[model samples]
Target: MASESTTEDHSAVKKPNGFPPLLSKKFGITDIKQDAVKWNKEWEAAIASLTAADVLKEISQKLDDSFFTPQHMELFHKSLRSLQTNVAEILSNLLNNGHFDTIWLLLNAAEQRKHILEGLKRASEDPSTIWGPDCRALCPEVTVSNFLSQSGKGFIDFLTRVAEIFGSPITPAFLPNSWWEQASNLPNPWWGQASDVSPQRQISQSTKLVFEVATITRNQFIGEWQFVLSSAFSIVSDITNRGEGMKEVLHFMENTKGHVARCLAEVKTTFRDKPIIRCENCTKTPDDIGQNVRFMVCSVCKTKLKFEVHYCSQSCQKEHWSVHKKACGKKKVTRGLSGTKGDFLWAFSDSDPVANLMRNLPKKEGRLTLRDIGVNPCNGKRSPAAERQAKMLEADKDVDYFLFTASGEPVRFVIDDLGAKMIFRINRGMIMTQPTDTTGVNAIGEYMLKLMSNYPGLSRDIIIKQLCEEYGEDIAEKIVELEQMAYSSDLLTVRCSVA
Candidate 1:
């Protein structure tokens, strides 16, 4: 506590309620050097007659004679241990596990605080603290109000808001440097008003006893608050600084990324579990079906033709056969270059023989090389034709594989290192069907379906619609027609086996 003279000097300075007075103009706000000098002189005078032995004896007597019983000390220790356990559990669940909701609350605390204040105000008829526009920036109202409201969530919200404002753990500096001196001068009516009776006159009465009890309670609260805050600050500082070269920060960021990835995976799984397209007969989307009703596509089209024509049930497909028969065997429509310029499509799928061949390339106890896939290495700087081949071969070093078009133009199949995305670009000339190898041509058409599977975020039908803009839908329909014949053969074999 500041001396009575120093406190009286500062009491004269006045400022608006909930606002601080200017440090220089304020009467009680003395320089740190002046405070240090005065404190040193007072301290020396007080301790001049007290030797080290006398000080130790006084302290020992106070400790032994104190009213705090052994039971009270045990309870105090138990309370501290309980606090530690609770704090550890909270950190493990929220911080260590990287809870999304908790991270969101921390990042959006400033914006969230507005709604929190509004909700708290709405919950109570009249808030105890003054939440004037100027005072709203302070957190004591939020902290006090939340605790009084008896809501665990409200307290967490208040703590998050406080953390955001402080940018660190709470410390002694949370209060102004001269808080003790300014306490008596507070604008609050209860604090500012002086008692009329003298302490000497009231000493014999119940008023004295009440005053002593209030003083003891205040001192005990201050001691507990200081201990908790200091212990927390120390622990946080140690853990944060334990790692070298900002490793802890990096580790925390990695954990956050992992948490976000898990959240995304869960969302993706939810979507993948549902049907990708609507029912062909009723034109009803997945949402239209009952929860227990499974969405299905035409098995004849899917298994044999690798085409998907969706439906909610077999009955709908059967009823719509008359209309669907006209285009039942048609391939899914595809568009050309719908994405950003130079954004090549990933020309790969489980059905594509080339993709399967590339994926299964031999890795005989080590990294697979070009020789393992039967491709000869380019030796560069031969004839003009050889040199041209050499450049393409050099490019192949970075890519997964290449497939040549009917016009002999090479399409590069590159895999992204970071994102693991497969992409392909046709260097020149359009892919067309040839009499010798129509299989290769059909593979390109299959890539359109692959694009839909690869980028699930985009609608499958929408991708087909866009693909139709570049490559006519007839190419797909032709493949579907061929697939129908193949499916008929498979059906005949199955029936023969049954017979």
Candidate 2:
């Protein structure tokens, strides 16, 4: 709160709604600075006294309350401006000290206040007349510039650091929906309503700034595409599994998918005109070897072929053919074999579990990834079964399974007879099964299957303990021996770790 004398002095300068006047020509710089300092100190005190819960409660109140007078709007602007200044100061200190978590919280709070302001602006009569001037007065650019200048950082540099901390692009995803849309309608802080400023000049400067930021941001995001996509997918999967905030999470996923698509498009475009310097298959450079290697472009991208791939050797080209064939000439391919079938399989094998699992289980047409068994790699709404499967897969990263099909379609399988048998059922009326011994092997297999069916990522030690409790120690040890043998022989692809 400002001093009584100061408040009284501003009384005569009040608007029709009895609120203090805007920071226009009527208010002197001295008065504005004094009031801003007072308000900023008050805001700091208020924030310090309250917990996160209290801040959230206040935000909720602001969001729910519809009837805000001009006085309320003016007070809100003052508070927001004060908060922004404090946030900037805190952010500068945090950045200097490398306290990223605190910085994230501050930025998140600033974003929430931005949303609250937008909500107020939207609820007002003639939004342009009511909140437009206030928005221009607030001038986010001032806060941005002050923080960046104090921190001795440029916008791109600041954003890059933010991206590294957040593990995502520093885009509107960090803010609420409609933030950019609302900002676009607001006045540019750099080029205000000055008589000397032309509309064309304003547009040109704004466009240049937008383009510069967008280009750098996009490039940075592209460089971290693997991490960006992986982290986004993980977030989406976790949210879906929790079964909370479905609508909001889905909306976010949709936006993220668009970003991923854009990044991929940029990658493709970047490669389009560039000379091939390395083997696409092995990712090796000619400099790695003594001789300059000749490269073979994909025949598809060339006149002779329909696939887009390059290799330093004919053997490498031939080796990648099975996976590449499925994606040749298609607009997009969701999954491609990363290497030779054996290489792909070997990556998942500390033992021959995959090979053994394939041998014991019935052979079926088509490849199956975790997705085929109900795990989803992308985000959004998922079936309850899919959600469960995803949770199971996430619980353990030590094990992985994938099935490849000639047709590039998913293969589905079900465990039958309580692990005594596994049925591979395909659409083409094909079935395969591995017989289990009636006494020792059958019971252990059944138990193992049931345990894994419910909890795919359960630890091996837990399973062994459960087996010991159910059967005798001798039988449990025997089962473990057999399991290890099966895994070693590639007859079961359950355990990915080496014994």
Candidate 3:
């Protein structure tokens, strides 16, 4: 990619179009703006003529065909992804601006199908007629989809259908599809169908439900074979189990519809509201001890949900639906009497298994960070690290934050949830004290970082709230001072007054 002469370009290297098509006019309407005007214009143009998005929707079925070699297939993927982006931006604006008239939405889907079908027909009949470096040879041996960007689940969901639309042989996904879930027929530390997975007899009905979903689409190989949908959740729901526990498990299943749906082919007819998920496998620790979670793979979809569980089976995963088939892997796994592992516990390893796992896994997106990896924690004695942590917590406590008068010695405080942030504003005699001198092995810092980084969508507001609730309103108030709560109500005047 040195700015060599025009003669060296891929288009030049291959006689695409038998001659390159002129560059698109700067006005061809391509930009990442999610504006409705752009979307309407683009769609209008598409309705008037054909576009990549439209074509992808139609020929989407033949995604895996010779329509692309690895390189070409990849380019197609990139182009298609861009198209999806365009549609999404357009759609979001429309939704927000109240532009969707049920008919338009319906037409949009149809239009997409038509475009993809047309692309396929053209590729099948006369690939050379299609212009660009992509459509040059009968098959380029390398195509774009192999070389460009792909969406997570959104991309795979679209790509899967594209392959379906074009009659391409669907293969087990070797790669993860969504940020949280890896798409695959293969079960990892989470999903699988055990030989003993019958209804009443099964140990984990929850896991069994999802196993069916993944395996239902699982194609079996038998020379030239007919694919038969298999039942992973053939187990009987225990009829006798109509207690509150069952109700909770059902509720868990209902809220996680999309999650459960991806892994389960058929959600049972919840006789009532789907009970909440009861995670028999979750280890309950006191909130004061720390409710921190780590990256974990789903027992159902193998998606990276922050929480981990000990239950490896559907029934157990469901029974433990209060939690999930995830665990803080800092602890070693041991088998339970029911042939399942106890709750996934947290362990700390200086070796850093998470960083290691990320290093080796296939990279779909070059930009994603630890946000996409599922890693087990390191294991070791908690006391040294814990004590060091406690000491540091103690040191933050020493900063005398409440100084009413310049002459008064600042009232030093143990940094609790409330006064931490506000104390920073008060610069009087503030010193950084070491509760514990161990920096490299600061388990608490590592612990907090792990929680924030790995558990996506965990909001700061929630963290603040949780801290406040755990430490008490006084600590919360001190950490984050409120003008009204501290002054106006006269209620807190009792604590803030210094005699």
Candidate 4:
């Protein structure tokens, strides 16, 4: 558990508004920190202000309407309408009976919801300060609840009400017979089990339980939507399952999947770190390998890059060398794609496929040097090149760039734009190193030179100067001559064609 000081620190640093207005209205409380007497008073007052229709409105608004299509939303609304009787009964039960167990559950649910909003609020404030599971460890007021455990039958128990509300819309597989497993399997306080504790203790436990359940459900809910959509799509994609308008069904589901993906993508920015620190090479944590082993950090990347890249063993490090060498100890820049709204991933622009081909195409040498072919070579300053590449990228918004390996294998570099940041990624063949040497003259140099000259102030002297410093005076002069020749050839071709 986190100490009293840590909990206080979180509360102190969080928003001063106490709680979000929408959340406060939903929970039927003015403040989350209230004691049993104050909380009950506020709760009763808030509930009294609502009619049965108001209760239904609150319940229906649980899931965002904009996220679903009209068709899908109609289905959801159908399910919600069917559950109106149940909603009324629950509301009546709450107003009349107001059982201790139900109140406890409701209180915990509200707490959980508040915690998520707080975390997201923090993330929106300072994105670079990590806010995921590892950072979450610093504040321990919120312990995980067994009711939401997916490995065991515990998660099934948490879904009991959700299952009730959605009813027949939920697939049988979503709630299998295995879901009937005994609640005793739950390690945390099962529903109604709080009766054993005194009223004072119950209130205290409710506050703590709210944090725990909120964290679990927040993380789980954000992560599960894609899985749910994928699972449904997979079931419907089968040939044997084909029916009339199956194509339309697949199309609708596919669009919904994209909508769900975009929503999850937004949620992902709130928490981007892995739950545990894992080996960058093998991707296994110390716990997975055993107590006898420990993870090692890349000393070069640590000292030079100031970024810790881990490996479980010497072998994994060596195996990953071919891939890691590209970005190892190289300077990287953090650019905000979404302004101040979300989280972002780090991207490397050490090599530009276009600029690389331009520099190497003019080479008269038999085999291309690493630098000529856009490999960092890990010998010279690479940040300048990265800076230049960043500028080059800004001039164009094209996301897809096609390039060929020395082996003539085609590969693509894609710019993946998250709401928070942009990531330069390769779909496949990332491990295949750039060509060392190849036969024949690639006339593509002329087109490349034409493109490179477009950059402001990139005169012959400037290109010559930059190249001379990076390579040598000899190679630099040769490249400038090639550029001149290529330009003259282009003019000549145009004249001949015109004649």
Largest lDDT belongs to which candidate? 1
lDDT of 2: 0.32
lDDT per residue (tens digit) for residues 290-345 in model 1: 68678777766677567777668889889877876765557542111111111121
* Candidate 1: RMSD to truth: 27.6
TM-score of 2: 0.23
Give the count of colliding residue pairs in each prediction. Answer: 6, 19, 92, 1
RMSD in order of candidates: 27.6, 21.0, 26.0, 23.5
Q: For candidate 4, list the clashing residue pairs, or say none.
A: 112-214
Per-residue lDDT over 85-129 for candidate 2, one digit per residue giving the tens place of the 0 to 100 score: 333343333333322222222122233233223222232212223
Q: Per-prediction TM-score, please?
A: 0.20, 0.23, 0.17, 0.22
Error of 1 at 211 (Å): 14
Preferred candidate (TM-score higher): 2 or 4: 2
Writing each residue's lDDT as its tens digit, candidate 4 over 110-173 gives 3323333333233223322112222222122122233212221232233343334333443211
Model 3: CA > 4 A from native: 1-30, 33-312, 317-406, 409-499
Candidate rank order under TM-score: 2, 4, 1, 3
* Whole-model alpha-carbon lDDT for candidate 4: 0.33
User: Model 3 over residues 1-499: C-alpha lDDT tens digits?
Assistant: 1122322344433311222212112125433144433433443443335432232222222111211223433443444344334333432332232211111111222232332222322332332322321121112111222211111122123333332422332232222223113222222222133443344432332322222222221111100011000000010011023233234323322222122211121111111111122223453222222444322334433333333343324454466544322442333323221212231111111133332333454455333232222111223232343333334343454432221112323223222322112212111111112312232212222222223323344433443443333223343333332211221122123112211
